[model samples]
Target: MLLFQLAFKYTKSQLQRPSYWLAVLSFALAISLMVVSLLVISAYEKTFEKSITQLLGQIQISYLSPNISLPKVLSYLQKEKIKVAKVTSFIHQEALLVKNGKVKGVLLEGLPAFEKKASSFFLKKTLNNTAITNFSKDRYGAYVPVLLMKDMSLQLGDAFSAVVAKSMGKNDFNRKVLKFYVKGVLDFGRSDYNRRYLLTSFEALQKPLKLSKKKTSGARLWLADKVFSEELSFKIQKHFSSKLIAQHWRQWANNLLEATKSQKKMIFLVLLIILIIAAFNIMSALFILIVQKTKELSILRVAGLSVTSIYAIFSLQAVFTGLLSLTLGFALGYLWAYLFLLIQSRYFSVLSQIYKLNHLKIGLPLWDMLIIIAVVLFLVLLTAIIPVYRAGKNSLPEGLSHEL
Candidate 1:
């Protein structure tokens, strides 16, 4: 009781100084910066992961053998009893597009109709979210992303000519010009999708690629448990023959994921450095306070309080300061993080286009918050230990003889 009262009184006295407030501010800023950075990075990763998985599925089963049929691989998957959400077939080819005197090279994506199983899976948000997909039912129709239209100066209902390579001899090829009408314009927000992708139907694509009903270049498999994508991929590789290769979605979005991970690490390192400096500020403040209060501590020791009890007074002050900082810092961090998220969602859609960020979301990761708490508490404890040990080491006689 005596020690706590002394601790409370001491903390109250220290609050009068501007340095104390500055230390608390530093702690709060550091916490807010780190928490916001962590939450933003987490949200980007989740959003991008969803976009890529929806487009490529959790696992892609691609085979080099032209003789391998989709039905055969599906039957094998069924026999293995592997849980799946959806299976889709995809075919893509590089072609030159000409419209309005503008010639641009683009990747043409051929999938089944929107009503069919193979189509753009943009992760529909609502029943009425028609813009999530721009697949046209007409075999002669093409869906163009709006960003690409701007680049090519194309509008809806315009004619697009694709220069596709067709096999003439066993090793020679000829360029076949195919014409189609623009069906719709898309605004999917991903850079690759906007700038490079042209949506076409399977019926239209098969004529050029010479693909039969049973054969496709690659098959996409969506799992009921997306978190186990890597595990399922490994299992597929082990069970399937050397001709079949399974790749996880991360492998497809490697560049994006790697950039996100690297940015996160760099930002974390910067914030951690800031927090360490803030902790050092606390250390300095506490040391100064201990010196200023040495006479009071000497009086207590002279009045028969044990050295341990005198040390307890300072240690308890540190605990109090640490807890107070933790509460304030967490509140500030949460506020800043959500506020930034709100700002981004409400106002930064254009900016997101500049960065190729699509389907960005706001999410709070509990494990990350827990880690921040643990780190802050550990630094607080370290800050307390060094000063308190110094206080405890002062001889009773020396304290008693000290001048105020």
Candidate 2:
């Protein structure tokens, strides 16, 4: 307790020193910089995940055949007690969208009118402005991406036509033009998805494509826990008897996921190098403090204080400094994150095309962040020990004879 008191006094005394404050500020800035970078990267990764999952679900069951029995697949999943959160069926076909004589090729997605999960792809902020209605209300209504709307010069309630293919024979193909009204506009973040994707009702597309009411291209399954996607996909394929194949989104989006991870590792390496330099700066400050107090330490030694007690006092002082710096750093980092999020919310739409995110959100698991902070603190203590140990080794005569 006495040694801790002495350590506290020495730590407080150093607060008035410019060199000590410089060390603290440097370490704090490094911490805040790392926190901000990590938060932004984490946000980007989550946005990518949401965009992919919104389009593909966690797992997709597809067949090359014109259609599959959606009820049978749903029953099979129920019979197997699969951990499915939501299942949405869709029909995917290539079609040509035409407006005012301008034609563009697009991927048409036919979603069931009852699947409210399909609304996930819509940018909610624009829903009020555009008056997005349910497909159930308007069977002939279509949802077009924002980019497609711009390219085709389309507006809500505008009439358009989709030229779909209907094969009349093995070698001959026929074209069927289906008219639709623009019901809503969507923003899926990625320019590719935004440019070429369109949505309509399953029945509206099924009849036009010469498919029966019981037919669909595929079903998307949202799992209770996505970590089990690969395992569930295998089980689904095994149960389907080759008529349908299940694929997890990770299969197609692996490159994006791997890139996010690699970028995170690169950022961490750069921040670690910065942290090491800051730690060395703090070490130098503490070393200088020990040198300046040599005579004071020698007087304490003469009064019967042991070298071990001297070492403990200095270690305590370092612990206090490290803890204080970390606290200030965390406060500054979170404050900045909050301010950035608040300010960026207003302009997210302008940035969404480039960043592929409709909104910016910051999330880092608290336990993981704590573990990182602990590792940093451990490194600081390890570095602090070197100077503390050297100070403890100073002989009584060497410390006493030093010029005051």
Candidate 3:
């Protein structure tokens, strides 16, 4: 009880000093800056991952044989339905879109109706709170990439036509032409996909291509769980006799994922450097405080306090400073994040010029918070150790007579 009272008294004395408050405030500012940076990066990564995964299923199944029929593949997938989340069959082909001899090459994707499976999948994966069954039910609805529309000077409800060709010789060539009214425009973040791709109903493409009812090009499979990609791919490949090629979505966006991972590591390293500097500041402050309090510590020793008790008193003061900084820092950080979000929301046009986002998103991961707290506590303890040891080892008269 006496030791506890001494520790409390020592910590209170430190807290009452302006220099101690300034040190605490500096540490808090440093911590808040680091935490806010981490939160911003983490939120960006989370949103980007969701956008990418929604645009491309976590896995895709393609034909090993170029001319493989879609019906057979659908049957195979149906037989292994337990492994897949959803299957979206699509035909992707290149076409020349000509209007008044202004020719442009486009990548056309023919899938289920814009209101059907594809739209549902997009809503489910991207929007999170929407239902797929509520999408528009227009039979001829088509989706065009924003870049494609911009290149063609097209608008929603504008009529556009394309000439589809097969790989056969000129005599055997069939010209498939159809006028389509633009239903929606997609703005996938990838420039290539945005510039080249168009989406339309599978029924619209099938009849124009004269494909049989049993034919389809390939299927995109959303795995029930991402971890099953390898095992399920192997099982499908073995069962399908090399007629099918299974690819995980990670493989498709490997470059993007790698870039994100590398950037995250760099950000962490940069923030860690900031935290290390803050730790050094804490060490310096504690050392100065020890020097200033040398006489008082000696007086405590003469009043029958043990060396271990003296060490405990200083250590407690250090811990109190650390905890106070952490509390104030976290509160200030959260307040800054909220204020940022509010300002961005109110003046998105102006903020977008700087942040490249419509709104500021700050997400604090629980594991990250725990790790940061642990590191800060460890650094605080380590920094205080030297000063505490010095106080414990110094002779009472020496400490009383000399500056620390």
Candidate 4:
């Protein structure tokens, strides 16, 4: 009790000094910066992962032949007791489009019409939400990429011609021309996808691709849990090894995912450097405070207080400062995050055109917060140890003779 009172009195006296406030401010700044940066990066990674996986599915199953029976695959999966969140079938092909005499090659994809209550997955990649809500309603309507729309000078409801090769040979090929109306503009946030992709109904492309209603190019599978993607993919591949191949989403976007991971590591490394500097500031401030209190500590020692008790008093002061800094830092960080979200909701445009998401989300990762707390506390404790040990070791005569 006596030691704590002495520690509190000493800490209170030091509040009038600039060095004390500098230490507190340094810690607070470091904590707040780390929290915000990590949250933003984590949100980016999650959005990117969802956009890619939702478009490609966690696992994709492709047939070895030109087309496979979609019904049979679904039935087989049901019989095999495989759990799936969602499944979508699509037909993909290459075609040439002409608008106003401008020629361009594009990858044409046909998706099945979803129920009125259920929305099509492709809508997530489109700029307009109502673009091709139900392909059954508008069979000839196509979702054109923004890049292609710009290149062809197309507007919504404009008509265009698509030529698909009925048969290909070395010297020549037979082609079939079809008319399609622009219903929506696609924006996947990547120039490569937005430059050459067109989406339409499965029924529209069946005759052109020479496939029946029962056939499809491939099926995409979304799992109930992402962690089981690789395992389920392997199982599905082994089960239908002769007829179909299964691939996980990680296989499709390995490079991009790896790049995000590297980016996160780089961000953490930079923030950690700042944190280390803050720790140094803390050490310097505490050392200075100890020097200024030399005469007071000597008085306590002369009054029969043990060196160990003196050490405990300084330790208490260090802990109090650290806890106070953490509280202020977290409060400031969360306040900033809330204000950012408010701003995002009211007055926001797409922040980055290179990423898949049009909006940003702020996420609080508990594990990350815990890690930061542990690291800061550890650094503070380590920093406090050195000066406290030096003070404990000071001879009574030296402290009594020394002047502040």
Candidate 5:
């Protein structure tokens, strides 16, 4: 109880030092930097995760292998208790999109949603097209990406040609040139998709590619949620033959997912280093305080205070200092983060458009953040031990006769 009195008195007397205010400001900035970093990185990761989900379904079934008989797949899908929400087949093909002296290769996706005559019209309008409707009836219609429009100088109602073939060898005699009507443009926010993709309904690609009405390249399976898909994906792999490949988005967007995780971890490490440097600043402040109070501590020792009590006084001072710094830092960090988010969300919408960023979330999973903050606070408080030892180890006569 007496130790608390000395700690409070000492801290109050030391508040006149400019170094104390500097320490508070430094620690506040460091903590705020960490908080903002966590929020931005988390939001960035979530955007990419959503992009992955849209591009690749929860699970995919590929029928490329010849041994993958259709009967086994149908039977497996018919089993009860499977949490299958929807399964849609798609026609994925690599085709050459040739326009006025500019040619680019793109993945042409044929989806069932584009089955009707009015589907292309909606695709055009949604892809930032000024034109209202598509030109073709049952003929080939292609919705190119925005990247293609800029590079190829394409326009709605324009005519273009697509070469759909396995090989580039013109002498092989299997290549087919299918002319198409420019229906619209697409922008899914991912640069890869916006630059190298074209959309067509299954009907549009059927006559051009010579495929059966119901046949498709592969099927996309969506489960109720991501949690159920993992176990379901494993079950799909175990129950299905090796000839057929059953996969989830992790397998489909493996490179993207790996990159996002790595970037997040790297950002976290950088934050940790900065926070540690702040702790070091606090350590220096404590050492200076103990040195400045050395004579006062000697007087206390002369007045019947034990060495243990002296040490406890400094320890209590450190705890109080850390608590005060934390309070100030939390307030500063949240205010700064709020202002930053406001500026970013309002002024940098172009970046959001390019990157497909949704609302920025600030330090979600509040309990986990609380745990990390607690651990960091504990570590900072430990820095007091060094100064406490140095100030309390000397005898009463030695402390009283200090030169300074």
Candidate 6:
């Protein structure tokens, strides 16, 4: 109890030093910036993943070998009924779309006209078109991305021909021309996907490609929730054994994930450097406090206070400073994040120009918050240790006799 009283008194005295306030402000600023940057990166990664998963199903199942028998694939799918949610087959092929004597390479995707699980954002966008009411009946009508339509100089109701390549018995290429009407145009917010992709009902490509009703390039596996994608993918692979290749959305966008991860790592490294610099400021502040309190510490020692008690006093002072800074920093950081979100949403276009993002996004993961608190506490303790040790070692007469 006596030691605790001395510790409290020392802590109060340390607060009077100008160096203490400077250290607190510096540490707070560094932490706020680091937290905001982390939140922004995390939110962007999540949004990008959601966009990709909406366009492509959570998991995709394809033939492992080059041309597996259709019956074998169906048999494996039947066996995995419990794990599968909704299985929709699709045909993906590259074709040259020609208009006005100009040709552009396009990825043609053939899916069912009426998708039962049409709640996805991409599906909603596709269905918003007013041109074609019944996609099933309009076998010749097709949907093209807005960028592709512009590149091909295609207008509503305009007709375009697609030349599809076919593989014969030998290593040969055969060409088949199919006419298609422009029914709708879409924009997926990605320039590359929008510029080279075309969407059509299953019946449109089946006849031209000479594929049976049961055969498709691949099958998309939609789970009840996006969270089950990884588990479902593993189940699918085990059920299919060697007959099929199972991949989740993460695998489909491997490059994007890798890039995001690398960028996050770099940001973390930069933040760590900032934190170290802040910690150095804390060390300097504590050292200054030690010099200022040398005489007081010596007086406390002369009044029957132990060296350990003196050490604890300075350590408690440092901890209190860190905690106070942490509290203020978190509040300011979150306020900044909320305000930025509001501003971006209100003036999205202008903000997009400034940040290269459609809007401000911030995601504060609980783990990251805990990590920040732990790091701050650790740094505070580390910076306090040396100064506390020096204060504890001061001779009673020598320290008290020194002039400020």
Q: Which candidate is the best by TM-score?
A: 2
- Which pairs of residues collide in candidate 6? none
lDDT of 5: 0.71
Off by over 4 Å in 3: 1-18, 25-37, 66-82, 97-103, 116-139, 167-172, 189-191, 234-241, 291-306, 309-313, 323-365, 397-404
Tens-digit lDDT track of model 3 for 1-404: 77677667766777777877787887888778767766766765665555556655665677778556656656776687755667677777778876555779987778765555555433212212233233433334467766677788877666667878864675787677755666676765445666677777777677767676556667776667777765776676777777777776666656766876787778777877777677777777788777887888788789888888877877777777788888987888777777866875786655334323344446888877887687777778888898889878888788889754
**Native-vs-model 3 lDDT?**
0.69
TM-score for each prediction? Answer: 0.74, 0.83, 0.73, 0.76, 0.67, 0.69
State residue 47's C-alpha deviation in candidate 4, in Å: 2.0
- Least lDDT summed over 10 consecutive residues: which range in candidate 1? 123-132
Residue 274 CA error for candidate 2 (Å)? Answer: 2.5
Candidate 6, residues 128-223: lDDT per residue as tens digits? 346555444524767787778889888866778998998886888899887787766665555566777788777788886778876778877667
Q: Which stretch of 10 consecutive residues in model 4 shows the poorest summed lDDT?
A: 114-123
* Tens digit of per-residue lDDT, candidate 4, span 82-149: 77788889887789999888999998888887323123434433324465453344247778877788
On TM-score, the stronger of 3 and 4 is 4
lDDT of 5 by residue, 104-205 (tens): 888888878763533422244532234425445444666776767777788766788887885435666366777777766665556566676777788777
Against the true structure, candidate 6 has what lDDT?
Answer: 0.74
lDDT per residue for candidate 2 within 1-404, as digits (tens), equals 99999999988899999989999988888888778777777877777777778888988888765545777877877897877888888888899998899999999899887235446777422234244453333247677888899999998777788898888899999998887777677888776788898887787787767687777788998988888878888887887767888898778768767988898889888988888788887788789889988989999999999999999998888888888778877777777887877777675555465565656667865754886588568867888898999889998999999984
Candidate 1's TM-score: 0.74
* Model 6 regions more than 4 Å off: 1-21, 36-51, 64-82, 113-141, 153-161, 166-189, 207-211, 222-243, 248-267, 290-313, 323-365, 393-404
Look at candidate 2 and give me any clashing residue pairs: none
In TM-score terms, candidate 3 sits at 0.73
Error of 1 at 33 (Å): 3.9
lDDT for 282 (candidate 6): 82
Q: What is the model-wide C-alpha lDDT for candidate 2? A: 0.80
